[model samples]
Target: MARWGWASFLLRRLTGTFVVVVLLSVGVFGLLYLAPGSIQQTLLGTRPATPETIAAIQARYHLNDPVAVQYLRWLGGAVSGDLGVSIRTGMPVSGMLGGRLSLTLALTGYGTLLAALVGIPLGIVGALRQGRTADRLVVTAGVVGLSAPPFAAGLLLLVVFTGDLGWFPGYGAGEGFADTLWHLTLPAVALAAGAVGLLIRFTRAALVRELDQDYVVFARARGLGAPLVLWYAMRNSLVPILTATGLIVTGMLVGTVLVEVTFALPGLGSLLVDSVTFKDVPVVQALALLLTLLIAAVNLLVDLGYSAVDPRVRLGGRTS
Candidate 1:
């Protein structure tokens, strides 16, 4: 039964991912079609564009094809690892993404690590010391973190660390691992601050509930030490915290776009914004597709993770 249930869940996730991919592809292609002017004319410009040259360009790019046909052609190319040539740079979309994907991945990785490192502990402290001085301090810090905007945080850091103190690079992904980390520190902190706040709030709330459960009382009655009680209680409380953390991480993926642009970092978010402004359709489409896939994958992973954190969730999912 467990095996069958797991299989069913996997199948459902796969199906949903496929549907989302198709919809995203259609939407991106539709945007290109709906954009002003002809695709061929837009690319070749008005520098004496002959019909012969226009026809040749259309034939080269399948622009003469119907909208559905063009979409299918693009979809077919996408399946075969061809994301189409960039309308602006005449470079392969995959090449462009491959070059910048690492920077974005590094930023997200560092930011998420910082968030978890800071958030989990603060949450634990808040939960353990509920209604005390420590709790109040944690809550106040969480509120501040939640209220801080990533761009504002980034700008402030830039002013203090770069402008005033003359420490760290103001913008750009610096060369070398050490330099890159130094460059990423401020942006990652800015991005993760809110996540830390959210995690603390979630953890405190969840742990408070768990601490009041009958099993917690049983543990206390059995003469368990405060440390043991806290540990056991926290393990159960983490389920909801995990759920909220997953959501925060998902949001961070999109939220990092603005910060990336503001800092002029050579990440996927920056690339997407620049491409869109320049009307680089292929690049924009590919990035959008990749981001959609990434978000869907993250959500799927979070769903899978929930079962491991909470047996009740697994049983509930199976029964439902």
Candidate 2:
């Protein structure tokens, strides 16, 4: 595609993503507003909800303002890098999120890497073997992985690895890089199980289709080795794999709440759960917005990856 075409595509996608973020913010804010109980109630804890106390709390936090005005103020603050103080902790939401965000990102990164490393090769082997015993075994494993929920899988891992065998630490993000990796092992495996299953299935299907194409057959017929031919076929089949990977990574990031809770990890997912339980609207809003932004950014990267992987995929035109 031409430079102008690529730029136009990016502009359109960015504009659409921005609109989505705005709508998501509004929806989250509205839901919080409609939730039962006032922020003052949460702030007061066991203290009596006296009129003077309520009035003072309202004035202090502008809680009595119109819903639209409150949202606007919050949005303006977010734009200025101020996500407001947490009602539960009385600390800046950004500060509370900083370290936790890094931990979550690390968990997601490690899980995704593990999934890709295991899934892609197994898929290729399964596809090449077709109906052989190895293929059947891979298929069965994939089915089992897909059938099990992350929490269930996590518990199973916890039982076997932490309870019986005593292999890895059961919880926490740990202290340093090596310790963190050690602690994250089981959680990452549990988090990646479903993704691995999906990738195995997707990769096998894509490779099967690619191998049936005339180009693959011709390449093999030309006396190219099996490895070279398979390599070429894999390249041709990458688009679907890339798409699945992006979705898997996003799901892992957003769905880490259960895994984090299971492992007692202090990540964004756990933070989100805590914020919701405590009715900390500012923290909840900020986290929700951050997740939405992450999804949008990943989608944009996937679109760009499409053009990179497939030469025929032009930005603003039919595949050439």
Candidate 3:
């Protein structure tokens, strides 16, 4: 890689982000308009729209314009932080989302942290003890985790921990930082479970592949200890693990909906559900864009994280 690799990579990512956002914005707006009774009926309520009234409404919201024009117009406003007002409550979409942002972030953040903490280590251990009972046990546990989807796992956690054991509270996001974290523990665990399982398998497979490479054999032949050789294998295996982690993070963001509903947390996912239920066009559009940007941003970071993943990888990756 050249020194300009980082710039080239970042520029490429940004351009892709721009294209995706444009297409997504167009699709979301167009599809919403096409959906029967999604916005028109919701906006009109039970009363029929007279020609004059229909014209006025269309003019006001730019509904009469072509989709491309409408998208560009909306895009202009969006770049400046104006997401428009929520049709349901007349609240600024940005403000509404901001209010619930922290809790949702906390939940997803905690879940990702937990998944990494639990998954990576177990994966390492499994790889080291491949074909052993411990490896089989780890694989079994991962299957169990993946089998119990977030909602079911959440419910079970609520019943056993909150109901029987009385170890944690059942609902609400709680108040204050400490209280919030305390409240989110079970939900986070439930959210992290599937991700943990995925990471375990991904990490194990990656490490195993890396360990079998000629480089690892050469290192061993050079008299480096097992620990050092294993460390090198682990380091080389990070690209896949990081890729999986990025996906997990994005998945957690979207996956929060069911978990929030189950745990009664007021996050973006729940907000999105309610917005869609009420046919709040502005809120839904804003959220769709937000989630897309977040996912794109994570992928960009992961891409940047490649050679940058381990500085030693810079020869082939960015930051050379």
**In candidate 2, which residue pairs get closer than 3 Å at backbone N, Cα or C atoms, i.e. clash?**
none
Q: For candidate 1, lDDT tens digit of each residue in 1-320?
A: 76666666667777887898788878876766666788776656444579898888789878767878888988898888899888778799999999998988788888888998999889889988999999999999999999998888888888998899987778998999999999998889888988889988988888889899999999899999998998988888777877877787777788778889878898998888888788787788888888887887887778777777765456546444
Model 3 Cα shift for residue 230 (angstroms): 1.7
lDDT, model 2: 0.86
Best by TM-score: 2
TM-scores for the candidates? 0.91, 0.93, 0.92
- Give each model's whole-structure lDDT: 0.83, 0.86, 0.85
- Could you give candidate 3's per-residue lDDT for residues 1-320 as a string of tens digits? 46565566667777988898778877766655765764555555445778787776677678877877878888888888998888788789999999988888889999999999999999998999999999999999888877878888999999999999999989998888899899999999999999999999999999988988999999999999999998888888999999989989999999899999888888998999998887777888889888888887888788778757676444434233
Q: How many residue pairs clash in each candidate?
A: 0, 0, 0
What tens-digit string does per-residue lDDT give for candidate 2 at 236-277?
899999998999889898869999999999999999999888
| Worst-scoring 10-residue span by lDDT in model 2 | 311-320
- List candidate 1 stretches off by more than 4 Å: 41-50, 315-320
- List per-candidate RMSD values in Å: 2.2, 1.9, 2.3
Q: Give the TM-score of candidate 2.
A: 0.93
